[model samples]
Target: MKIGVVTFPGTLDDRDAARAVRLAGGEAVSLWHADTNLHKVDAVVLPGGFSYGDYLRCGAIAAQAPVMESIIKAAKGGLPVLGICNGFQVLVESHLLPGGLIRNEHQHFICRDQKLIVESNTTAWTNQFSLNEEITIPLKNGEGGYIATDETLKRLEGEGLITFRYKEVNPNGSMNDIAGLRNERGNVVGLMPHPEHAVEPGFGPDTKIAMRSGVDGLKFFTSVINSLVNA
Candidate 1:
């Protein structure tokens, strides 16, 4: 399978996301923000970082990029799309996903190994995980809090669209401890954690067995490949 990793002007984790795709047994393709073409990728990932230096609002400018125009159309047609951190903000700004992310309640940037529970495993990006399974991934963001209207929140909960939830603690004051979400079609997912950072055992969050040994995030890539293969 070929997965496309998009790189915005200020994206910092595109390479990491590409590496994760490769490590998960898929070909990684590069997609640029200015390009309308997706290069025929099976799925697409919008990795973390401050796009346009978070001007106006995080991911606000990047949401209007040419690449997103193509991605939004494809995503509606069932192409899988995963957005992380600032990319999550873009997904919301582009209206690809519901709700919005805002500055942390503490008014400071945060970086840490975050624990998340798989709330829904039916999405293309989360099929490899078991429901309610806990995994650790790196999270870094200044504006990561998630908010939504009551009706939207009820709909998400009723439809099982909440893909991941914060475990142990709510790190960013996101409502209902939402850490990630999938669209109604299950082809689009957005989260504030950097799953790309946890794909490599030696470089990811530490585990009880060994230092920096967690590789739970690799499942996100493999799950998408599996979804494509089965499709």
Candidate 2:
């Protein structure tokens, strides 16, 4: 499978995302934000970054990019799309996902290894995870707090669209401690954590077994590959 990792002007983690794809035995295709073509990739990922310098609003400008126009259409047709960190902001801005992200409750940029519980394992990006399983992923963001209307929150919970939730503590004050969410079709997923940063055994978050041994994020890329192969 080929996964396209999009790079906006100020994107910081496109390479990391691409590396994760390659490590998962998939071809990593580089995608530019302005390019309308997706190069026939099987899946697309919007990596973390401060696109357009986060001007106007985080991801607001990038959401209007030509590439997003194509992605939005493709995603609606069931193409799998995963958005991480600032990419999550773009997904919400593009209306590909519900809710909004705002500045952290304490109004400061935060970076840490965040523990998340797998709330749903049915999405294309999360099928490898077990329900209620706990995993740690790197998280760094300024505007990472998630907010949603009451009705939308109810629907998300009732429909099992909530994919991941903060395990022990809410780092960003998101409503209901939602760490991630999936679309109704389960192909589109957006989360604030940087799973790409946790794919390698020696470079990821520290684990009880050994220093920097956690590689739980590798399952995300592998899960998508499996989903495509089995589809």
Candidate 3:
């Protein structure tokens, strides 16, 4: 399968995301923010970074980019989309997923290896995870807090749309420790962690087995490949 990784100006992790895709056994296609085409890719990934320098609001301006126009339509039609960190901000800003990401309650940027639990593994991005499995991935963001109206939160909870939850601590004060979410169709997912950073052995997070050997995040990409193959 071919997975397109979108790159907006100031995007920092597009190459990492593409590498993850390649490591997951898929062809990585580079998609630019200025282009309205998706290049016939099978899936899309919005990588992390401060697009438009996070001016006005994180992802607010980049959400209006030409590529997002195509992405929005494709996502609604069941194209698999994964948004990480700043990309999560863009997904919320694009209204592809519910709720919004605000600044961390502590008012500072944070970077760490964070624990997350797989809440629902039925989504395209998370199908490789076992239910309730705990995994650690890199979490770094300034405006990573997730918020939604009470009604929306209730709806998401009731509908089983919550995909991942913070396992031990809420790193950015996301409501109910929601680290990630999926759309009702389970095709689109947005999260505030950098899964791409954890796809390699020596570069991944430290784990009990070995230093920087936790490659749990590789499943996020492989899951999509499996999903597409099984589809």
In terms of lDDT, the best-performing candidate is 2
Q: What is the C-alpha lDDT of each candidate?
A: 0.93, 0.95, 0.94
Residues 1-231 of candidate 2 have per-residue lDDT tens digits of 989999999999999999999999999999999899999999999999999999999999999999999999999999999999999999999999999999999999999999999999999999999999888999999999999999999999999999999988899999999999999999999999999999988789876666437788999999999999999
Clashing pairs in model 1, backbone N/Cα/C closer than 3 A: none
Off by over 4 Å in 2: 210-212
How big is the RMSD of model 1? 1.3
- Please identify model 1 stretches exceeding 4 Å from their true place: 209-212
The pairs that clash in candidate 3 are: none
Cα RMSD of all models vs. native, in order, equals 1.3, 1.2, 1.3
- Candidate 3 lDDT over 108-185, as tens digits, reads 999999999999999999999999988999999999999999999999999999999998789889999999999999
- Determine which window of 10 residues in candidate 2 has minimal summed lDDT: 205-214
lDDT of 1 at 231: 94
